[model samples]
Target: MPRTALFVEIPGVLIAAWAPDLLLPNVGIALRRLRQRNVPVIAVTDHPPVEADEFPDFTERLQRAILEVGGELAGVYAALPDKPASWRKPRPGMLLAAARELEIDLPTSWLVGTDNADAHAAAQAGLAGVVLVEGVDPPTEELGIVVATARDLCDAPRVMIPRQGGCWHDHPQR
Candidate 1:
């Protein structure tokens, strides 16, 4: 089987809140299961610059939480520095950039995100599938599958068997 890669949007997917200390649920269980199955889980998010004077601790905390969860973050890509102002999600830049940095085959990978636009970006980037979390508006076009929970991604036949006791949360939009 071709190796599977996961491109997750952190702000609204894995974490529930960032301010007043991170309030991440046990989403790590799902990630840990993926890791056990040899699937590479990479976080591709658009966060403020690490050097931002206003929120110096934001990046650090986020990284720490991701690490605690066993996620292999592919480095947060900033649209301001790396690409033109026109580059943003719904555009394939972030996803493509992460794929390149991680040296993964984009066309054979799975992109799971809370936003429907991410599904569009995944399609544009030629990803194998886009797993959209339930409760989000369904994509008008065929992007990929709609999963009820983040753990459902692991249950997909193409991915891995669903493990019990994985954390499930309805992540709020940031």
Candidate 2:
């Protein structure tokens, strides 16, 4: 079985709404379940440099929240403000970086995004598959990319687990 690493986008996927820092419904419960199952989760996000500088401890706070809920945050990688366009979801820089840091095989990994472009990017980056949260329609034709849908964040792991087997770390190959 191939190892599965979860690459999530924070603001829309994990965070409750489009507003200021509201956690989406059922996020905590879902995260706990993923953790109990030994899944690795990494937040691949894009935040303005000014926000990072002004808040300073924002990333730490996000990581702490995940820890408090029993989920292991492999790491948080944000796109540089200066290079915003290149670091956005359709681009795979942050996802690639997380795979390297987590020692996850991109070809066997899975990425869950709040939208289509994010999922498409993961597939483009060589991930085995991508999961789009409900409400976003997947492409009519497969682009050599496997796609799935989670009714919401709570359903994401449930949707991903059966699709992606055990972590590659547990296998002898790595």
Candidate 3:
């Protein structure tokens, strides 16, 4: 089975991990690209059991860590959900809600996550693209196009949002 990976901009840092100790090799490239573009990145995560204000600090720290880890960030939303709703992975609620709140174009935005839940959520919301990383089961060929492997998501071709009007692809198409 395919390895399970987690590609998430969490409250503590921009992280990408594969099951059983796998990690993204090209994470540096992705971070550099994100910084170069100056795009706003938010971590739409399952709310921690901590106080509300604590997340802001966590978000800031995570942003710093992403930079330390070679990630660029314009900002972070770090929104929390009360239950398993659209804001959670596989539902597209979190991505869609974040995009709307951030005033970003859905098609221009990309969701890089490890599980099929993330891909499903990205697709459900009609985002520009979704990249599934290691750990998730191999899609039965019913999901949208596979943009890249976990190690090469940032270096792969970027999906552009024509309706919004901008070039997002910084590398060759996969």
Candidate 4:
């Protein structure tokens, strides 16, 4: 079977802002827990429009941010402003690229994000589902891919992932 992976969107899921300093409360603990289980976590992000290929220091900042929060990543992929449309959110390119690079099985993988674009992209990319960290009270109808919602990244597992395959990063412990 193709290995399942976890795609965590930056800004909202991990950090509350674009900078490396604002990691959401308890996200660091949650991310570290995932690593202890051997789940390969990947970071995927989209930056605001910029004149260059990417926002200066975005990759470096992202890495420092994750590491600072006690989390680790199997890989990192960012959709640059100057990159093709397919690489941006509301599209499947970045996720697809990460999946291909990591040999991930999209249909069994999961994405945790905070926007409608995140849900749309995960669905388009064929991921099994999405955990909307911030969304409507009853968000299921908004996107076919949104399988659950949590108050924040810290609450995801308890809210939806009660058992293996129940929600985001729903793979058996390796």
Which pairs clash in model 3? 3-134, 3-135, 4-134, 4-135, 5-134, 12-62, 86-93, 87-94
**Candidate 4: stretches off by over 4 Å:** 48-56, 135-146, 159-174
In the range 1-174, model 1's lDDT, one tens digit per residue, is 234477776555556534424524555666766666566777655554334354436656766776677754545554445465434778888777776676767655667777777777777887756666535765776554332234443343343222222222211111
What lDDT, from 0 to 1, does candidate 4 have?
0.73
**TM-score of each candidate structure, all chains considered together:** 0.68, 0.80, 0.63, 0.80
| Whole-model lDDT per candidate | 0.57, 0.69, 0.51, 0.73
Per-residue lDDT of model 3, residues 1-174, tens digit only? 111112354422234322212224565576666556655555555544245657666556656656776765544544464444556666766665556555656644566655566667767776655555443454554655334334345533353333344555332232
lDDT of 4 by residue, 5-83 (tens): 7888877787766455477788888887877776778888875323244456656665677777767888878776556
Give the clash count for model 1.
Answer: 0
Q: Say which candidate scores most in lDDT.
A: 4
Consecutive 10-residue window with the lowest summed lDDT within model 1: 165-174
Q: Which candidate order results from sorting by TM-score in descending order?
A: 2, 4, 1, 3
lDDT, residue 25, candidate 2: 75
Question: Which sequence of candidate numbers ranks them by lDDT, best first?
Answer: 4, 2, 1, 3
For candidate 1, what is the lDDT? 0.57
Q: Please, what are the lDDT tens digits per residue for candidate 2 over residues 121-159?
A: 787788867778857888676756678887777776555
Q: Candidate 3 local accuracy as lDDT?
A: 0.51
